[model samples]
Target chain A: MTDYIVPVLLFAACAVALRKKENAYDLMLLGAKDGLKLLVSLIPTLILLLTAVTMLRASGAMEMLSRFFAPAFSVLGIPPETAILVLVRPISGSAALALGADLMAQYGVDSLVGQTAAVMLGSTETTFYTISVYFGAAGIKKTRYTLPAALIADITGFVVASLTVRLFL
Target chain B: MVMSWIFTGLLALSLFASLVLGNGSALAAAVPQGARDGVNLVLSIAGSICLWSGVGKLMEVVGFTGFLSKLLSPLLHRLFPSTRQDKDLGQSLSANVCANFLGLGNAATPMGIQAAQRLAKRSEGIASDELCRLIVLNTASIQLLPANVAAVRVSLGCQTPFDILPAVWITSLCSASLGLCAAWLLGKVWRR
Candidate 1:
């Protein structure tokens, strides 16, 4: 969060410092306006994610799926709670965040599951949603190498998350 | 439009899948509930994502991006040394990088657009830098520690919510490194 504060100021400073008097105020205003549009565009997406996550938790997918995933992860030293994270990480980023929060709450952050979720958070990409929004917005009809590449990166993150937590936790 | 439709359909499919997975014997009875719940879930997630996106934009308005640029300047220089100084592309890259790190991805959308705008200017309509390259770069794997993730850990009542240092460092290091390498390779191929 500390890293976040100054960048907001950078927009105004960059506009004021770099642009002419005529352009400075104008560009900043345009940016501000576009910023709002950007925000507005994402509402439906967020609402959908939250609803799905809540429903899943209510549905007992959290408990049932954890059992299935626990044995698989034991080989990697990851606790089962972290399994829910890997499940949601791909489909919905917000859900994953919520799930991680729940895991943190019950298991405690010092626990291996909590630690693994933290690492997993930083490591992986939000594959389906990001691909859809980014490329869809750009009118990119095809991803070509992008899909495989993103997956490889995701696998690497999963492995590293497990390995690091196992070694350190 | 096609992609959107596909995604919507997939959401529906995932919902059905969840319903069946949960209620194999009572599929007909449960399907409707699952469908309604799934739609509601998607809507909620959409709202939250928009909220975070709004916050991220507010972040830009208040000048948080510039500071992030300076702070992450060293890493940016090392990662993408080819990017020029005094260019918004670098700033945009830094912004995207920062958003990814915070797991404020919906927020990173604007930064990606900004970076693309900069890249477009740098290429001067030559298509030399092709659009996908920016996407790949923006999609770079990030390393998050004391983030929404740590908050989750804390809420879950973990002893140390910030106990993910090892995983954060190692996983992010590998994923981001691989992302950069593959992206660079793809960029080279595109250039040819």
Candidate 2:
């Protein structure tokens, strides 16, 4: 079902273009070029972020911090084991993916903890990364209430993810 | 300013922790490994991003994005009142949300940035309420497919990866709704 979505969307777009007698091929090339430019501009930020997060993970700081936060998080129905995932998720996407993969591996993927971790990963975004990139591009110096609100949302996602998995999965 | 602090703090804290935990060597190795991984990640997504961007351009030319904007206008009009007066911004926001819903992170970012730029025009170097709300919307993760999570589950030997869809949906809806409400409430309070 999910696999069909992409192809279906593409087909619809192409059909529309043809009906409108638009030069679809040339426009696609132009957009692709713009995409390449966008990726090039994003490279530095992505590399720096990934490096810092990887260092933190490799040095075991994430594990240590997760251990400290485990009790608090457990009160919210999040298991102690997935504490690192919840922590890393808001800051880094790849790091969170790695942590989620590790959780599913350590516990069987069918286990409650693993299922909860997956749901959490699926439901939440990398808050810090999104905030920084979007605001930075807009040259907004004062983020005002964005960070607090985003963090609140993230916490809501994490807590609800655990509960949903527990009740449904 | 905040981003700078976060980047520096992440590096400083990691270095301090590595020295104390006797994992300095691992930390050293991870830096280059991570840089390589970042490049690889970009390369891996490049094809899809280009493809989607191309398709998105076609959609734009054919006015499909306008149709999408209208389709979602009732909710969007409230969330982004500026969209009612600014057609371009509305199209960009709709495109971004559509890409995000399909879990196309690469395609979403450019469109999101475009929308953000337009929103920023009304502010004086500070994020307006609408701009902040847009950021919140993006950060709340409203993806419907969650393909990446399902793939990871499949690799981990889960027979039915999509079984968690209901849980994902519930969590996403809850988070996005709560996040938007929090942003709106905070905006109201801060204005006082």
Candidate 3:
């Protein structure tokens, strides 16, 4: 963590130096321009997630789902919020992150829930939702097992975040 | 309406499931948490959206993105042979590539959209191979920095947020490589 700034600075420097002919700050500005295009595509996803999140909360369905998954997650040192990640992945990453932060606040850091939320945050990619929205807009006719591979990657990330946090943090 | 209702029911179920893990008292406490989460989610998404849109319009004006896109031209040229190697598509793609590396999801989404839109415009009468390839590439992107992941780690109280940096690069690169391979194979086998 202490050395993070060094790498970030170096990255900025290298990214700048490598493009010596162009201005580094300009690249950043360019990066920001790129960011805007992403904004357009993500609007629908945000709407979907917000609706889903609000409905889920008011309906009291979150509790039931949490109870069903608690035993399994508890065994792994995870709490309710962590289990939400599994369900939340198909919804929206940013929303899932919001929920994860919520869980962290409740369970207190160093608890299983906080750790799991952290890991889930780092590990998984939104599959059914993000892929569909992105590829759909792009006019991709075939997914070609892209979803399966990403799911596998998400699982790997979840497992890694869990074990690493447990052992190291 | 029926499908939306069904989705609403399903969402209700997911919420029900989220709550039962703790005592009912926790649910009351969770109200504020939910509100806070909602707000954060909105802010992050909005921040990302604003940042990226500005970036997109800016790069076009500055010409920096044009320079970067040129480097990928040889590969892009081959894949998108049917479409002319024009600047708009290339610019959109360069912006997207940079956004992905930064872990700016909201920003990447629109550029990806623009790239597709631009390609569609260029393709005119024919469905181009490069366009298909780019979609796969977009979904299976490498995301070199994984800033979001590191930030999550830090917030979770990790001594070092970037401890997973090496691991992320390796995994994302490998996965992206595989995705590219799969895309290539799909393009070849499905070649028309």
Candidate 4:
């Protein structure tokens, strides 16, 4: 089902273009060129943000912070060991994946922490990364309430992920 | 402005923590490594981004986007009233949401950027309420399939990788709903 999505969309697009007598190839090229420009603009933002996140992880600061927050997180029903996954999920996808994989390896994939980590990774987005890319491409600097609201969503995701794993799994 | 402060704080805290923990050398190495990783990530998704953007253009030219926006307009208009006034923005937002629904992150980003660009047009540098809602929607991640998580679970020898589908669905819907509500409340309170 997932595999057919792109092809189906493209087929529909082409069929429409053919019916409408539009020059689909030229329009596609024009759009691709615009995409390239957007990609170039996003490079600096991605590099800088990724570097900061990576540095935070590599310096063990993320682990330290996770440890600091573990007790509070546990009160919310999130396992203390999965605290790093919760913290990193909103900041960076790759880092969260790494942490999730590590948790699964350490605790076994069937364990409560492992399943919770998987569910959390599945459900949450890297808020900082997504915000930076979208806003940076448009050159918008003041995000206003986006970050706080997104964080609220993320915290909800983390909590719900744990609860669902406990109830269903 | 706030983003800059967060970025600075992250760097400052990382450097401070590394120095205190005697991990400065590792931190120094991670900077370059991270830049490389970022470039690699971009390279990986570049083709898909361009492809989707091209497809998006084709869709727009062929009026497929119009059809999509019309199909989704009822819900979209309620979430983003600006879409009712701006047809193009509606198309872009619909495309972004569709891509996200399919779990096509690479495709979603470019379409999302297009929508963000449209939403940013009226606001003078600061993000508008609609733009904030768009970000919240994307950050909440309402995707049909958790392919990445399933892949990791499969590699780690989980017998039923997709068993968590229901949980994923529940969490995603809840988070997106909560995020949108928060954005709406915040927008109402912080109206300037």
Tell me how far the alpha carbon of residue B20 in candidate 1 is from the true structure, in angstroms, after superposition.
Answer: 11
Worst lDDT run of 10 residues, candidate 1 chain B, spans B41-50
* Model 4 Cα lDDT, one tens digit per residue, B150-186: 6567667787777887888999999999999999999
For B77-186, candidate 2 gives per-residue lDDT tens digits of 89999998999998889888877876656668999999999999988779999999999999998876676667667766677877888889899999999999999999
User: Where does candidate 1 stray beyond 4 Å?
Assistant: A1-81, A105-109, B1-64, B67-82, B99-107, B117-133, B140-146, B185-192
Between the candidate structures 1 and 4, which one is better when assessed by DockQ? 4
Candidate 4 lDDT over A47-106, as tens digits, reads 777687678778888678778888898789998888766766777666566567657756
All candidates in order of lDDT, best leading: 2, 4, 1, 3
Assess each prediction's global lDDT (C-alpha) against the native: 0.57, 0.81, 0.56, 0.80
* TM-score of the B chain in each candidate versus the native B chain: 0.57, 0.68, 0.60, 0.66
Worst 10 residues of 4 chain B by lDDT: B60-69
Best by DockQ: 2
Q: Which number leads on TM-score? A: 2
Residue-wise lDDT of candidate 3 within B124-173, one digit each (tens)?
53335566556555545455445544444454455655555554454445
Reference-based lDDT, residue B5, model 1: 55
**Candidates' chain A TM-scores:** 0.62, 0.65, 0.64, 0.62
Quote the positional error of residue B187 for candidate 3 in Å: 4.7
Docking class of 4: acceptable
The 10-residue segment of model 2 chain A with minimum total lDDT is A1-10
All models, RMSD in angstroms? 7.7, 5.1, 6.8, 6.8
Scanning candidate 1 chain A in windows of ten residues, the lowest lDDT window is: A1-10
